[model samples]
Target: MVKINKMLKSLHISNYALIDTVDITFDNGFNIITGETGAGKSIMLGALSLILGERADIKAVRDSGKKSIIEATFEIDDYPTLKEYCLANDIEWDDTMCILRREVAPAGRSRAFINDSPVTLDLLSHVAMQLVDIHSQHQNQLLTSPEFQLRVIDSMAGNDTLLSDYRKRYAAFRSAVKRLHEAKRKIEQNRSDEDFTRFQLEQLDAMNLVADEQEQLEHEREILSNMTDIKSTINGALDALLNGNSNALSLLSEAGDYCEALGRILENADSLAERLQSARIEIQDIADTLSAFDSDLNADPAELDAIEERLNDIYALQHKHHVSTVGQLIELRESFRARLDELENSSFTIEELEKEARRAKSLAKELAAQLSKRRAEEAARFEADLRERAMPLGMKNLQIKVELTPTELSSTGADSIRFLFAFNKNQPLMPVGGTASGGEISRLMLSIKAIIADKMQLPSIIFDEVDTGVSGDVANRMGAMMQSIAANIQVMAITHLPQVAAKGNAHFKVYKQDDEHSTHTRIRRLSTDERIDELAVMLSGSTVDNAARANAKSLLNIK
Candidate 1:
């Protein structure tokens, strides 16, 4: 695995430059930050986290009336995922990408920007998760979350497909069970409502309604019943306009010709000529319309009687069904058919469902058993690995128990695993955070993290006061352990212990200085000489005593 060497090369902070605004660059391998109690040591870690999407304190921003901006330039190793992201998001990448986070503390609002583009907190958190794992002092407590435990077991199981299939089966079974209950309730309801249902079905069926045919037949009946009177009216109108002695076309034609002759004598007679011509055409059109109507108007008494009977049948059905339109009748027909189908086969469906549910119950129990066995094996190995890493962190006789037990019908197979432990062999096993002290919990969390680090594919691990409870030989062992861990990965620690602080390949110091009207935090990447001086100060407080400097100088680990 590639570790951060010259990565996170530079940092720039404005309006948030601590007591003394300063720009700093980092070195490779291990970096340690140590200072006096009130010297703002944790501020650097907090700023880094804030830029990584952690919410910052409202008052943390400077009173200069400008937004706080934290910009970090990084030289990342060949990370294909990050490279793909940069390309996709239009971020320029050349072995380096700039992540800039800005917080507008004026409105108590903060914004995170990666390469100067505003991003949502979730996206910032996702990108930050790929870049860093900031282990806060309180992060140790998150290890005991039940959801976290279940996630671990499922990850290790590597049988997610099988578990997915099991969950699908479980869901189907639950649905079947619910449906079966509803059907039974419906049957009981039908028994109580048997008389009403029989009455509705019988009444609907007796209507024997035809769907669109009823509306079509009624229109045919209306036309047929009026045929005789319609034919007589059309004939009389056609004769009056065409064949009568005073027919309109005969009178209009003579008048039109007379006006045409008068047009030669008078200017206004031109209008009369056009009007006469239009009037003759209107008379012809009226005669043609009546002729067509007369041809189409024939009366047949037998057909009229048949049409009337059809309409009566439709009206009778409508009255019986209590519906006003043929469309409503169509809907009633469909409803009747659907309910009839349901009543017909509800028995067969219930029988098949009962059989399938029993089969599902048997299969679920079988798979759950196999899943529980695998989890037990994984749990044992997991505990062994945790205890092995915990030994050097002042946790001798520390016992880690991965308790795998069956939960009641969970989608994730059947196993529920929890991290349980005891400080000594004879002591009862208690949860990592509940019964164990803070120091013990911290060590346990570190041990667990160490055990999973390689598998987790994490390149850098930041420890915030991880050495708070350690002392003497145990503290010395921690320093050596961290150095060994650093040989393969980058380890940065915020420590008070000289052993841990002295073990880093690089060191920095954070301090606060007062100005004319305000306080600011200043951080400097310490050189060998500066580190030694700072370590001396950390060891002896205000008096740097020669022995502390000598101790700082002599401590070194191989690259």
Candidate 2:
């Protein structure tokens, strides 16, 4: 596959550390950055780190009253995964370029943005991981990490899909096991509470609770308690309306007769008579209704006692269940019955879950075995490749082996991987960290990176003086390896070695400038002549002579 070139186009930093403001555009290939001790090369890397979602510190601010800003722009024309990542995360997407920015306020507050949309630090870190890989001197300690060792091998093995599949199977197995255990626990607990649950269900079933039954029973009880008053009132109303001598019905009838006589001589009198008739009819209906009510009002003491007892039962259940209505009590009763039913059938559920767990475990184990097989196959190739790459970098008698030991299935797989090394002939192999020197480790890291560069899918890698303990020919060889790797990806190196610095397609010099009150750090791209002078200075240390310039020209092949 033709790898898409995704490189950091430019980085802008302001009010950060010793840099008031610095903007540097990078090249697409090997880019070199060189500076004297304490000239702020690392500070520039620190600013870039902020863009990569490193933790922000208020102390990095050049001025306590001003906010520090770090922004990085990348060329990402054909990187579809990154575009998909932005869309997945709801970040604004730009087809050809991506901008990542970080701001740290004077109060130590931090914010990150992608394509100008706000994002969390974690998301920014994930996106930036695809854009750049920054290897510093401290990262050398990763050589001792088993996880890192496994990742290195996996990257070379091209096991992205297989690893993803194995992890999914492993996760399913873990979930199934958890569910099976929970089901067993639930069965045990329900067995302990079986009698109590059965008793509760039986009590609710005997009551046979109904919806709205409580309100209906309470209303019946109220009417029964006031039965005498209600009956007397109804009788009085019926008499006043119908049976009394001066009842409303009789007076309304007499008024209707007068209105009918007046209608013969007056126009509206007939309408008035009709209205009086309507009023009499209405009074008669009211008397009939009152009579029925009086007849129905029987003082049934037995029914009253029955209603009271039912209401007390309802209230007792409501209190016991912590409910306020008959509906809620009914719902609680059904829930208890459901729990009992589930308990009765719990053994079946447990059996099913156990079967599911066993299936999942079997599938995971199968995939783990396949993963182990592939890793074993790749381990031999990786061992040979590492030995070949490192042997050229001063490990003349290098003997490297990748140890893959069987382990219980984990998220990564069922293998524990370690890199064993013997830097001399007839030397017993030990773990790389115990056997290799700092310089040897550096070279091994570089060689590993070179082997996996095409697979990492990263746009750029910045080496922060990873060539720490090497000198002369080894440094030159490391630079050559970086240059070779850059043929397929962007490479940036910070070095004090002219041998390494001479190998870059573009060079930048970082230096300190002293003003009146404070010192400032500045970096600028170097011209061809300026690069030569800088190389001469790096070679001679504070003195540039004819021979150093000639040697610098010789290194640059400027004969």
Top candidate (TM-score): 2
lDDT of 1: 0.71
Residue-level lDDT of model 1, residues 1-559, one tens digit each, is: 3454325666677666463355777655667877778777666766777767787776767664777766666657667777688668765555555565656565678787777677777666676667666676577657888776766655565656667777887787777788788877776666566666666667656656566877687777777777777777777887677888887777778787898889888888877968977887887898898888777766778887886776676666579779887678668766656555566777986788788777776777677777787778777777777788887677788877788777777777677778888887689888777678777777766666655544444546677887787787777767766666665556777888887888887787877878798777787778777888787776677688778778767664312
Roughly what TM-score does model 2 have, to 2 decimal places? 0.84
lDDT of each: 0.71, 0.89
After superposing candidate 1 on the true structure, give the runs of residues whose Cα lies further than 4 Å from its correct spot.
1-13, 16-30, 48-56, 69-104, 109-133, 153-204, 214-233, 240-332, 358-366, 424-426, 457-461, 480-491, 502-506, 514-517, 532-554
Per-residue lDDT value at 343 in model 1: 64
Put down candidate 2 lDDT per residue, 12-59, tens digits, no spaces: 999999999999999889999999999999899888888778889899
